[model samples]
Target: MPETVTPLGDGPGSEPGGTPGGTPQPPRGGRGRRTALIAAAVAVVAAVAVVGALGLGGGDGGTGAPPRSGSLVPVTRTTLTERTEVDGELGYGKEIPLPVRATGTVTWLPRPGAAAGRGDTLLRVDDRPVVLLYGALPMYRDLGLTAARPATPAESAPPPAGPGAPAKPSGTAAPRQSAPASPRQSAREVKGMDVLQFETNLAALGHTGFTVDETFTARTAEAVKRWQGSLGLPRTGRVGVGDVIYAGGRIRVGHAGVRVGSAAAENALTYTSTSRKVVVNASAADASWAVRGTAVRVTLPSGTTVKGVVASVGKQATAASEGGGKDGSEQGGAATVPVTVTIGDQRALGRLESGPVTVAYVGREVKDVLAVPVAALVALAEGGHGLETADGAFVAVRTGLFADGKVEVSGRGVREGLRVRIPE
Candidate 1:
């Protein structure tokens, strides 16, 4: 059984041993009131002391201090655009390695930074000049002449002396003109898309007669002979395997890999399209912002700002090595996707070569919306969140999009120019 407890202030109709209630004698009116007043005063004093000890009173300089009042910030309506800046490179876009088809000692090379157009001489191998042509098909076989019967001396001779032909001057023998030696012919006979490339190049160079096709016909041989003759080469009606380099367009030599005496090999030079462009490697997370056709701002090294548009975005991501580690390994690396941006105003770049640049990608936007500092929001004891009014009253609010240190807010009492407190 639990022990019986008695209250400190218990006073009642008395019973034997204070076990039961009975009619109790009443004290003098004045003294009874005095005792009651003194007990009440003591209880009040003890309550104050306990509150102070627990640091729950406003008078305490600790956690018990009065609520702090924060400064007010006015809500405003404006247009907000999410923008991100990333590092980029300004140049002629990606570098394409030029493969050499002919193998020999590098006899001569175009000067660095030179621009070579279709049908222009790009370099020389063993004293044989390799020409640059505009085409996607690579040269795979030697272009040569088809064997044909030699012209008879009578057919080659100037009109046979006819009975009525003008008498030759005395001592002036008819100049003998031997038909040009049969154009040189190659043993390696080939026909494919490479032949079509040759025909296209011949046509582009103003030599036309044969149809542009995969077959190497006698007409193509004749055209080749004409082209060779124009170039002051032996009109052999033949082209060697290393006669031409096929490219997409005019190529600007960015770098040379072979020297005067180096053996000609693949990737003898690196070149790019003449058009300038900007390339940016962006994190995969930001790939969505690099959609093609999106306008952007490019900050050049000279501090010039030019408008540009997204040209292309890579579909795949790749690891990009950043800083070098102590053990000579990649450090702080991340996967990135390539994005190409084309400048709208090409002249603005001036004579700037390849260099570091900055590109800004504009993202989502919110317009004509009421927004407040993100710090203005406060949690309420009653649940949910609210903003403190100028008069220290808490008004509940609902939040929407959050961006740029500001958040969209709405509530019954929220309005434009309404000041809301922000924590310092």
Candidate 2:
């Protein structure tokens, strides 16, 4: 007789051949599941044994060569960067004070948002145009012969030889010392540096025929008269403190300080650079990337990305806004250094004039590093992580920067083009 097979009985505590509805089947279902689980476990053990023979680094597998197939990736040589983004504003940089020096009624002014460039009228005083000049120094004194002193031999003379000073070598004369100035000359003329600065701007405005020097000669007067004639003003041949406004570069009117008809006071209006730039109140700790000449990236309100560079970093720190949960309130706001970033491609900004922008700052980077997919690393029982080869061998690696799903790895065996097995 063939051996009899005991079918899975229904319910626990029920023996084979008991009644058809012998025991509670719900109770029996649990036992049946346990039996199935045991069988599944046995199959898994068999599968693991096969993997051991293939030599996984963490398992008691054979030290065989890496296999030729199965999820594999090659080590790559590339650069890994850690980037951080901060909130920024997109507008003409910081608004600088552009006060007026001309004493007259605000008879005429540029439009509220109008821009001005070299030789352009910023505003009108007594119906005369107040021109714009590119320079760092402001005109504090009139530029005319009255304030200029000649650079004569007396001015260039060296100081007299000190007591007991060594005599000059034979056939070579010593430097002559400058003589003491008389009371009439002791008061001194205006600083020559100021003159040089004024003349530099004067020369840049197509006004030539005079040497750009500290001395404002008669030729310089002639050039000034010509410039005055072009501007439809009285040919005074002199530039007073109120005649022009000195600025770093092209400027755009930002805010009007007073009404159009108001008397022109010391403060006229505020202005900023004409081009759009990004300003970030970066945390003082993040100033490393906020240095001048550091490259960065910017995202516009339209979701467009462009390149930029750090233009300047503020020396002072601003206190963070206190409190929270209110409109414009921030909590634990970090004290920040003002950072100015400028973009080269202005057209890429499209029509975005002023709005919020995101600035990406690079913190740290490792270049020309050998890297592999993070998934390829296996935790070692001994400690740390390792990369398993295809054939069953393992390559111990020292891990570095973890970025963009790739890890920087270096070791005796880690090298570019080396293939490593990845887990499924």
Note the Cα lDDT for every prediction shown: 0.76, 0.78
Screening candidate 1 with a backbone cut-off below 3 angstroms (N, C-alpha, C), the clashing residue pairs are 13-22
Candidate 2 TM-score, true structure as reference: 0.67
Q: What are the clash counts of all predictions, listed in order? A: 1, 10
lDDT of 1 by residue, 75-189 (tens): 8997666776788888897668786888889898888789999888888888777889888878777776556666687876576678988987999885876556534442234
lDDT of 1: 0.76
Alpha carbon deviation, residue 230, candidate 1 (Å): 2.6
The candidate 2 region of ten consecutive residues with least summed lDDT is 323-332
User: Per-residue lDDT for 74-148 in model 2, tens only?
Assistant: 999999988877778898876777857888788787777798898899888778788888878877777765533
User: What TM-score would each prediction reach against the true structure?
Assistant: 0.57, 0.67
- The reply for model 2, stretches above 4 Å from the true place, is 1-46, 49-72, 145-191, 285-289, 302-304, 322-331, 345-348, 378-398, 410-413, 421-424
Question: Which stretch of 10 consecutive residues in model 1 shows the poorest summed lDDT?
Answer: 57-66
